[model samples]
Target: MSDLGALFYYLGIEVRQGKEALTLDQSTYASKLLEQSSMAECKPCVTPMEERLKLTKASTAAKIDATLYRSIVGGLRYLVHTRPDIAFAVGYVSRFMEDPRENH
Candidate 1:
């Protein structure tokens, strides 16, 4: 096939091509995810998770909607293709899918 042109976006990831490099990002996907999770207005943080933060199945914590948690995690997993920075955090939270708590 012939070269179509510089790719700008594909599969939820944005593409920016320059003379010496190409950049891929998922800001749109992330924004949509936040909206879907009802966290669109939440404050942004420099790090996905706190340093040395430990998460466990808090039996005493209030229960959350398993479906919502799973859906969010699933979206994050998909986003990993372009945003590996969040892989660890997403994977960590995904571990509690079966019984996610409010603190998860």
Candidate 2:
């Protein structure tokens, strides 16, 4: 076995080790996720989700591609590891993966 030195990148996370702290970043992964969802130019929100927004399993909105929806949700789920601030938002979207709609 060989050592790879400091863990700069692993899986989709970028790691930085400083004298006082360790930092984990996922900007590249998040960007790729945005591109995959065809939202590369989406705006950033101070809040990951809208306040008081509610999503339901049943909806009148038209259906969207379930595969792509699931993929994006999965990426967001993974992102929650390094970006725990978005866990609630990711979990909110994950509920509709079975039948994602335009409103999802």
State, as a TM-score between 0 and 1, how close model 2 is to the true structure. Answer: 0.91
TM-score of each: 0.84, 0.91
Q: Give the alpha carbon lDDT tens digit for every residue of 1-104 in model 2.
A: 99889999999899999999999999999999999988999888899889999888778999988998898899899999998999998888888877899983
The residue-by-residue lDDT of candidate 1 on 1-104, one tens digit each, is: 99988789898889999999899898889999999999999998889888897888866789988899899999999999987888999988888998999974
Instruction: Point out the worst 10-residue segment of candidate 2 by lDDT.
Output: 95-104
Please report how far candidate 2 places residue 73 from its true position, in Å.
0.1
Give candidate 1 misplaced runs (Cα > 4 Å).
1-3
- Residue runs of model 2 more than 4 Å from their true location after superposition: none
